[model samples]
Target: MVKLTLIRGLPGSGKSTLANTIDAVHLEADMYFVNQQGEYCYQPDKIAQAHQWCQQQTEQQLALGHDVVVANTFVQQWEMQAYRDLANKYQAELEIVCCNGQYSNVHGVSALTIANMRAKWQD
Candidate 1:
C-alpha cells in the first residue's frame, strides 16, 4: 500500500519546504496551471484541467507503489475531502498535516513570502 501525505496550508506556509523535508515528490498546485514561461494565468477551464492532471498523477504514483505528497493550500473542506476520498479509493494511507498558524507567529515567513506565492498563482 502507498502512503499519501497531503500538506495543507496557506500560501508561504512552507508546504513545499515540508514536502522537501520528507523527501517526497512535491506536487505544487501551481504547476498544474503555470506554463513553462510562467506567463499565462490560470483560467477556470485550466484550473479544472490541472486538478484532473493532479488526480491522475496521484493515481499513477500510488500505482507504482510510491508515496505522494501534495503541497497545496487545501483551505476548503471540499478540497480536503476530495483528497481523503481519493486515498480511500486507492487504499492508500492518508495523512493530512494542517499547517495552520497565525501569520504573526509563523516564523521565517514574511509578508513578502505570501505576496510572492500569490503572484505565482495570480489569475
Candidate 2:
C-alpha cells in the first residue's frame, strides 16, 4: 500500500527529522539547499525550483509504486493541495503528519523566522 505522506509544520518543527526516519522515498525541498560541494547553501532564489524538483522526484517514485514522503513547511492548506492531487491521481493513501514541537531546524533558520512560520501555520 503506497502512501503519500506529507510532514507539515514550521521550520523547527521536526518535519525533516521525521521524514528522514521514514522508509518511504522521503523528499524535501530543503534537500536542494546542498550545493555540489555537499555544503548547505540555501538559495532563496531557487526555492521554487527546489519544490518543483521535490514534486518531480515524488512523482517518479510514485510511478515506481513506492511510498513517498514530502517534508516541508506546508503552513497553509493550499500549500498541500498539489500533493493531495498527486496522491489522488496515483490512487495512493494520503497521510498528513503535523510536527508541532519547536526546536533547532537543520537548515539553521532563525528562531524569528520559525516563529513567523508557526504563526502562519494552519491545520
Candidate 3:
C-alpha cells in the first residue's frame, strides 16, 4: 500500500535522519536549498517556494503510486494540512511522526529560532 509519512520536528531533531531510513521517496523543503554542488545554502526569502516545491514533488510521487516521506519542521497544525489533503486526494495511508532527538542542526538554525518554533509547536 502507498503511504505518505510526515516527519515533523525542530531543526537538529532526527527528522531527516529517520526519513532516510524509510523506504520511500523522502523529501524535505530544506532540500530546495541544496545547490548543484551538493551544498546547503539556505535562503530565508525562498522558504515559501521551498515548501511549494516539496509539496509538488510529493504529489508527483504519489501520483505515480509511490510511497513518500516528508521531513520538515512542521511547528503548527496548519503547516501539515496540505500533506493531509494530498494523502486524502491520493487515498494513501497517512502517518505523522515527530522527532525529538537533540542533535546539532546541520543548517545552523539559531537557538532563538528553535526556541520560537518550540513555543509555537502544536503537539
lDDT values, one for every candidate:
0.71, 0.88, 0.97
RMSD of 3: 0.5
How far is 73's C-alpha from truth in model 2 (Å)? Answer: 0.8
Q: Which portions of model 2 show Cα errors greater than 4 Å?
A: none
Model 1 misplaced stretches (Cα beyond 4 Å): 37-45, 101-123
- Summarize candidate 2's per-residue lDDT along 1-123 as a digit string, tens digits: 689999998877888889889999988898888889888899899999999898888889998999999998889999888898899989999999999877877788887877787788787
Tens-digit lDDT track of model 3 for 3-109: 99999999999999999999999999999999999999999999999999999999999999999999999999999999999999999999999999999999999
Among these predictions, the greatest TM-score belongs to 3
Angstrom error of the Cα, residue 89, model 1: value is: 2.0
lDDT of 2 at 108: 80
TM-score of predicted model 1? Answer: 0.70
Whichever of 1 and 3 has more TM-score, that candidate is 3
The deviation in Å at residue 69 for candidate 3 is: 0.2
lDDT of 2: 0.88
Candidate 1: clashing residue pairs, number: 0
| Candidate 3 deviant stretches above 4 angstroms | none
* Alpha-carbon RMSD to native, per candidate: 6.8, 1.2, 0.5
Clashing pairs in 2: none
